[model samples]
Target: MMQYRFPENFWWGSASSGPQSEGATLRDGKSATIWDKWFDESPNRFFNQVGPQDTSTFYDHFRSDIQLMKQLNHNTFRTSIAWARLIPNGTGEVNPLAVRFYNDMLDELLANGIEPFINLFHFDMPLCMQEKGGWESREVVDAYADFAETCFRLFGGKVKFWFTFNEPIVPVEGGYLYDFHYPNVVDFRRAATVAYHTMLAHAKAVQRYRALQQEGQIGIVLNLTPSYPRSQHPSDLQASKIADLFFNRSFLDPAVKGEYPAELVELLKQYDQLPHCEAGDAELLAQGKVDLLGVNYYQPRRVKARANAVNPASPFMPEWFFDYYEMPGRKMNPHRGWEIYEKGIYDILINLRDNYGNIPSYISENGMGVEGEEKFLVEGQIQDDYRIKFVSDHLQWLHKGISENCACKGYHLWTFIDNWSWSNAYKNRYGFVQLDLATQKRTIKKSGEWFADVSRNNGF
Candidate 1:
């Protein structure tokens, strides 16, 4: 029954972040991040008033979690280092406790036969740094590079896989364009600035990693949403391309090719929305070319030509170029309300193969988040057969991509154990192992058991 077999040494695990899992935020010399400050200032902004402190407490229970990962047959996992936890001030002396914690955590993972993929930034900016305009300031960019260099010097011996930023555009979208995150600003120009500087910070991190001569791979995690036009009309096709240019190529080009797309630059220039760039930024971006890439695919974006003319007085935004088109009869995840386009995964891989040189890559984060998951629990366990099908269906396409010479090396689910999600809080659970918020209890769901077999067999 093993119809799809992955290549040898395929990465099989999940991804989580410190802000969503680690509970002891204020203790142990860790300074407040934007999450903490935002939650404190406006608790109602979070779902059910759940703050960052309400998590699965991975800080105290990582040992058991690692054991659970072993049981699930995970060969690798990805998590982020909280900047506020590592460097309390984001630029000053490194916290001794933070160093000890990371060292022990990495050593424990390695000892358990699990490879740790460390991501430097996961949208957790230190409060102090945010006061200095967060990613908008060149000073914060320099501080981020210093923080990255400190991490390389301290833990480079243990972690062989390092990522600069996880979905670098989320902060730009959430904080600047949308009102979902902290320091909410509804300005397209500010969002453009944030996106540019974040990539600049990433390039600076990559430059530092290479300069240190560390024996490892450095890359960035991009949540690539493939754009599909509703029709073959020229306007629809152009709309789709513009959406792709604004969302995907904005980060992907600079991260992989070390340069911005010419079309994108020209478009920005036409709109007068280009971010301020320094003299040597072009060279720095070229140096930031990644050795690997982590692709996080959740859903496909459907777009069509704008139905109505935009008001000339309205502020500039990516949406002015296109309108979201909902295709008829598209498959959907009933629980999460996201489209179930399994082929999107393969399309992304083939795009990388044909266009982006087939650089070494992997499915960094993919999973189905279901609300009210406990309703499906039976006999004291969650019978998440839906999740099992979701993974297998995606993997079949992934296997096909690999067979066709795509260089995707591994697959990591969105998470291992259900942890606190930002703003959504525990609204949607996307994990093989379900975590009980009240008692901090973790139980492997049916999908976890199924994944263990798939991982053991290298496929199914």
Candidate 2:
């Protein structure tokens, strides 16, 4: 509290997605998404078997939700449009009801004095698209650009900040390696191809948005995991460098600089598994650097060189290059099991300021997800002291970065309300507001009050 306050124009708010918050998927003639498809196949995968249909029911309560947002002192609100809802078949037909729904929602947000920051894709691909190879096909990239162009034409006037996708790498890890998401496959070649096509799709979307001359800013949100070697040993340092090349630079270099890291390319070439690319793909990527960047930094990667001999029979893994170093006494998220290092947030901003161009950016998604959150509720309000502490600590580092002239604009929580996380369901709550799934009631958490004050005063 001793140092400084953020600038006046900082965009303060929270974020959510259509698939996560807005239930009533079956009612609006909306076809199923990958989540819907997954729940149908394996109900046991989700926590308490809770699926998308049992979400926060924002579809019916959006008007009142906007009023609640005003009470929370939000200057901006981020939400995604469901691709399945936009085009039920994802190509041929447009759902008029879906168009009306989004239009009304955007209008209400504007009327409530909250700027709408819309995201086109948020990891919920339409089930129909997934049935056709999804991002693996070049045709799907064209479809995504078509979808994005349609959104810009429809909501460009009200939505000032547009994000092409949220945490693109999550799918590669979740779907390919971990089997936590739908279409789960543990193939490194497919992972490389998926990663390549996602970046291409992002560039394609941005190019279309600019071509349309829309009255908004288009950017992509990347979850940056900065790498730290466990020790000063040569092998450990080399391991960290390779980890950085694959995890961070693989996308960061292409997104910010429009070219993948040379080391990453060499690694792919070694396997003879590089993704298919056209002659003009590199030029297209270079032409569409984002106007703004949304950074989602949760933690840093602690790495050490592979101490043991590599397993000859083991399946392909990112861990082959390095081992996860468990640093003793590192702070951890009590409920979610993620490490909490407030300095990581500052380090991320400084990296962007130094290595990546000092692009206009902000914390897009960063919050602690706690289990059994209802136990902390007090008299109908959630007394989320832990969440408040988390945000306060992160904000202090953010403020320091700002003081050092890092081009940060503001901080947005991971979410606005407790919503359906893809496979985890209600296992972890990362919302500023507690959502009662059964009753559709929204209660402001203790952290929401802290954020409101930060928004009101422009700082703590």
Candidate 3:
């Protein structure tokens, strides 16, 4: 007796990035991205020495992959254009072969009745730009805007939905605060600078897109991790507020409201960590607000007041303001080691409705990844019942939001296939189709078949 159904013309698909899914990292006049160079510098950093070049070969096999999308009843599919592949030097001459490949891919998707959602940057920066300080440099920001403009002019007519960046905060956290991602450094000031420039680049790109008068919607994808206080205690509440301000509002407010949060700005000034900004930057941001938003929700963040006072002599970081507190008896994703809180998705949508003017948005990524998923294989098909339940539970909440008139549009999974993750490689698979790395074979999982039915019925 399933009753919940998504809105008419609701989008159903999965998301992927060029570096993760496309294997031709260096072919067809493509230049090296940071991932390729990082792998070369430190092979031991990635899992089993797997590199960016080892992917699902989507660059060559996109025709068959689009067919698989039709079979799965996907009315939409999202993928990113590799900046290095499109413009080998990041801001100079364009690559004709890369242009042909992307044009063909977009055309094929449209030909099969699948809408193409294209993102400009997905953590894959060209090595030349990285050498010149990456996002930390305003020059790189300008270069990125040029790259984005090139994309809009080249593909905006065919691709109606455009995203400026995917999970913009991830790079800031990974490369600056943590040492997991490339250019790994432990400098909060540098992280702030990089984050500021990324938003600036997004704004500039939005400005460029508007100037072109392209008939499409442009937005940014943010992984909104709802911060929950441990209790109603004032200290815990304050901690959670600060975490939300630093992690979520830092980019959300600027991208949506075209301004940074006042509290966030004051905190940065207090810590003497405010990033350098040039003249007209604020105006650029204010003029370039997004037309749509893409939200990627996977888990909630639990936080509490700091247990100890910070030493004034130590370097300042966002962690100085609060502490992560793992709640006991919380549901957990065993394979990915992340807490599972399905209500977080609903909370995010409602927050947007009440606080952010109900900006049009969609669930850009929501999925569960399992380690060694092949264990569930039976008769050459994976019975991913857990993933099905996970998606259904989240969709039920999304339907609730839509019913309440939350401007939510669609739900796209984290991935279309088991593509290669940066450091984790293929350890945690989060795809409806199983990709056999050895054979390059694609087999639809049981969840894939069930998802197709849900899509065809527009409900479950």
Error of 1 at 55 (Å): 1.2
* lDDT values, one for every candidate: 0.94, 0.87, 0.93
The C-alpha stretches of model 1 lying farther than 4 A from their native spots are none
Q: 396, model 3: CA deviation in Å?
A: 0.8
Give per-residue CA lDDT, model 1, range 65-181, as digits (tens): 999999999999999898899999989899999999999999999999999999999989999999999999999999999999999999999999999999998999999987899
What is candidate 3's lDDT per residue for 1-460, written digit by digit as tens? 5598788999999999898999989998999988999999999999889999999999989999999999999999999999999999888899999999999999999999999999999999899999999999999999999999999989988999999999999999999998999999888999999999999999999999989998989999999999999999999999999999999999999999999999999999998899998899899989768999999999999999999999887778888989999999999988789888888999999999999999999999999999989999999999999999999999999998889989999999888889999999998999999999999999999999999999999998
Better of 1 and 3 by lDDT: 1
Q: Over the full model, what C-alpha lDDT does candidate 2 score relative to the true structure?
A: 0.87
On the 0 to 100 scale, the lDDT of residue 336 in model 2 is 84
- Between prediction 2 and prediction 3, the one with superior TM-score is 3
The Cα RMSD in angstroms, rounded to one decimal, for candidate 2 relative to the true structure is 1.3
Stretches > 4 Å off in candidate 3: none
